[model samples]
Target: MLSETPRTRHRRIKENGRTDPADLHAVLAAGQVAHLGVVVDGHPMVVPTVYGHDHERIFLHGSVASRSLAGRGEVCVTVTVFDGLVLARSVFEHGVNYRSAMIYGVPRAVTDPGDLLYGLRLLTEHAAPGQWDYARRPSKKELAATRLLALPLAEASVKISDGFPDDGDGPDAALGLWAGRLPAVAAWGTPEPDPRLAAGIEPPPHIAGRAGAALHPRRPPPG
Candidate 1:
C-alpha cells in the first residue's frame, strides 16, 4: 500500500480512500468508460470516452481531430463503476457503493502505426472479450483517422465504498425502516442480427458465449 501524497492524500473520508496499487488497477479495469479532463486555450474541458488499461498505463481513444485529443501537456482521467446502492433508514445516510480511480499525468500521443494498432486492439478487447479477433481489423485509413493517448499510472488515486448503512447504531435505526444493499448488475441482451445478413448465417461462438454472463466488476469489498 502506498502512503498519501500531496495530490492523492485522503483528508476527508480518509477511511474510504485506498492507496494500494492493485486496488487502483481493479477499478480501472472494471470501468468501460472514463472522463478525460484537459485544458484547451484558457478553458477546461472534460469529455466522456472509452478507455483501456494495462498494468503500467491507461489508453484513451478518439478521433485525431477531436478537441479532447489536443495532445496538451497535462491531463486528468477518472473511471468509476457503481456496485450497488446502500439504503439507510434515514435519507441523509443513504449512500452508493462504488469504485473509482483518478489518474493525473501528461499523456503521450501514439504516432507509430504499430503501437497505435496495438493500443486500438487493447481498447476493443477491453470492452468486449474476444472481439478484436472476431471482428474486421481496422484499415490503414481508419487507423490514421483515430487518435490514441497513453498516460502512465504512476500518479493515481483509488477510492472505494462498500458497506452497510453507517447509521445502524444511530438514531435513524429506531425508525424501523428497511436498510441494506441493493446490488447493481448488468448483462447483455439477446444479440440482434443485422438486417442485411445472409439468411443462413448464425452468431459466432465468441458472441454467443456472453449470453447471461455477469457484467459486474471482479473487485473485492472495500479495503
Candidate 2:
C-alpha cells in the first residue's frame, strides 16, 4: 500500500507522515485555501488561492490574464488544516496538530467550454456549497475571462500530527506546567446576507444550516 517515491519520502518525524490516500483527500477537502507554487519567467512565485478537488484532480481558477496561471510547468500545491495547538511543558516540545498535503505535477489548462464551467462550479461549491445553484451561472463573457487549471493527484505527499503533547515522560514534565492539546475546531459563523440583496431574500438553508458546524472529520466512517 506504500506509494512512497523518492520525491515523497518522509524524512523527519516519519511517524507523522501519512501514507493513507484518504488522509490526503480529507485534508484537502477540509481546507478552503491552498498555496500554489510555480516558477514563471525564471522567477518563483507562491500564491494563495481557493481550490476544489474530486477523486483524482484539483481545480484552480483565476483571472484569464493572470501571468502565473498561464505557466504550464511543474507546480507544487499544498493544503493544510490546523486542528489544534500542541502545548507542551517546554518551548522545544511545542508543536501543532494538523493535516497537510502536497501535490506535485504540471497542471493542465482547462479550455474546453463545458469542462471549464464544470470545474468552476466545483471550485465555487467547495468554498460555499449551493452557491453556484443560488447565483447566476457564468455568462459567455465571464467564462471567457476566467482561467482554470487542473492538477492530477498521481504524485503527492500527506502528513498528519494529531497526538497529545509528547512531554509526559520527558524531563520538561517535571516543570509542572500544563501539557496538553488546545483543540481548534473551525466552525461556520452567522451568515451576513449581502447588503445589496433583494429585501425579501434570505440566507438559503444549505448555507444557514452550516453555522457552527465542525469542519474536520473527528473519526473514520463506519462500515
lDDT of each: 0.85, 0.85
Candidate 1, residues 50-149, lDDT tens digits: the string is 9777778888999999988878888989998998999999888898999888888899999998888778877988888789998899998988898999
Residue 182 miss distance in model 2 (angstroms):
0.8
Candidate 2 lDDT over residue span 72-109, tens digit each: 88999999889899988988889999888999989999
lDDT score, candidate 2 = 0.85
Superposing all C-alpha atoms, what RMSD in Å does each candidate have to the true structure? 2.7, 2.2
Alpha-carbon TM-score of each model against the true structure:
0.92, 0.93
Q: Tell how far residue 137 is off in model 1, in angstroms.
A: 1.3
For all candidates, what are the clash counts? 0, 0
lDDT of 2 at 185: 73
Task: Give me candidate 1's TM-score against the actual structure.
Answer: 0.92
Rate residue 78 of model 1 by lDDT: 94
Say what the RMSD of model 1 is. Answer: 2.7
